[model samples]
Target: MYLRTLYKYKKWLFWLVTIVIVIQGIIFLKQGAVATPFFNYGMYSEKIPYLDNYPVYKIYANGKLLQGNDFSIQGWDRIYVPLLKFEGKDTVNAEMIDIRNRLLYKLRLGSLDRKNAHFENPDFDDQDFYSWYRQYLSCVTGVSVNDLLIVKQDYQWNGSRLLPGDSLVIWPTIP
Candidate 1:
């Protein structure tokens, strides 16, 4: 009787085992490719194999980023992000920018009027850059998502961050 029951369910068991094997195979394939960089290293192009899904399309025209979204050029690539004009208040954070741009965008957040990016403490520095930056950033408190923000690197207040109103000019020198 037990043998008959086992045989009766043999087909179901076979398919179940096959499904599990297929899943394992896919996981293994992804793991094998885990060594690859998501931003796509080694010259920006589809010529590289198995790296097509890299999120950033890293626009290149005349061998430079002309305009781009959800992409990053390799190395110290430079971009002259047009001055992001502000229409209202906004809050800038790492997660929000990362999701918007599809990259881990880091920000130093300071005023274009300031010269540094450090939010200094008398104990930390003679001045606080973030505080100066907040004077501008805090405008986000009651503003719409369509506000503007002049972003810069964590130290260089020359403009590196991007907000909604800012039209990012993709054409810039590649680092």
Candidate 2:
């Protein structure tokens, strides 16, 4: 009787295990590829294997490099890169720009102002981001917020290494 029951439900068990494995595999692949598409499941376009084609943003204030823990460029590399590429000149990118601009204006970093494929400011703009960044800078560097000269520099990555690239002036303070 037990053997018969097991055999009867074996197909259901097999399907359940298969579904779980597929979901786990998708997650693992997504992590490895950043914002990658799976059978066009999570993305509109086919997944590309170039993981290192992302850009890295570096922040410097008062001629001193800021700590990466305080602000991360992962969001740009993970979320924005894929969207910008797939959506092109769609409303999604515009909305993202607007959100970024609002944050920049609040942080007094100036607007990110984009022109064509280039960003005029490239400087990040987020309020909660600013709150923590300001506090972190104050505590870590003991530098007054007004005296810091903040700037953002972007580097292109080629799956393995980063190359020299664009620089944006975020905060200009006289020395």
Candidate 3:
């Protein structure tokens, strides 16, 4: 029964297999190129580099330290992902500018003008990010956040355990 069905769709199957093979060949030849639908496995073929230190944001809401162990994976993500994104806003802006310039150049619209270009960053510039973050945290944690403290701590792995090093309070600083 299966063989009869396979035989019936043999022509369609042949074309489908041929198209996939062609796409795979193109992806292989392109090397590091990002081809969606048919991905280049070369992207994951390289070994990830080892890092000596890892920076983590320790968030305290209303004098209580929020531990990842106490929350679900998604809950922890909601707590820290915005902080990571907000911290790298400048880097994101720079990449966005580069992308815009490349797109303009590709479409024969000339390069981006540093002084005159009206390019605005897609991410909203929140001068008082901590204030907003405090409110956001309140909503996420289901508690009123009167005080918020974000400590950027660098941790080093010493084979056995992670040792906390130099800490800096990044939020709620005195003027």
Report lDDT (CA) for all predictions: 0.33, 0.51, 0.78
Between prediction 2 and prediction 3, which has the larger lDDT? 3
1 against 3, candidate with superior TM-score:
3
lDDT: the better of candidates 1 and 3: 3
Inter-residue clash pairs, candidate 3:
none
- What does candidate 2's lDDT look like per residue over 80-123, in tens digits? 34323332334236666666677677888763454324532234
Global CA lDDT computed for model 3: 0.78
Candidate number with the higher TM-score (2 or 3): 3
Best by TM-score: 3
TM-score of each: 0.16, 0.31, 0.69
Ranking by lDDT: 3, 2, 1
In terms of TM-score, how similar is model 2 to the real structure? 0.31
Error of 2 at 109 (Å): 39
**Native-vs-model 1 lDDT?**
0.33
For model 1, the stretches where C-alpha displacement exceeds 4 angstroms are 1-8, 32-175
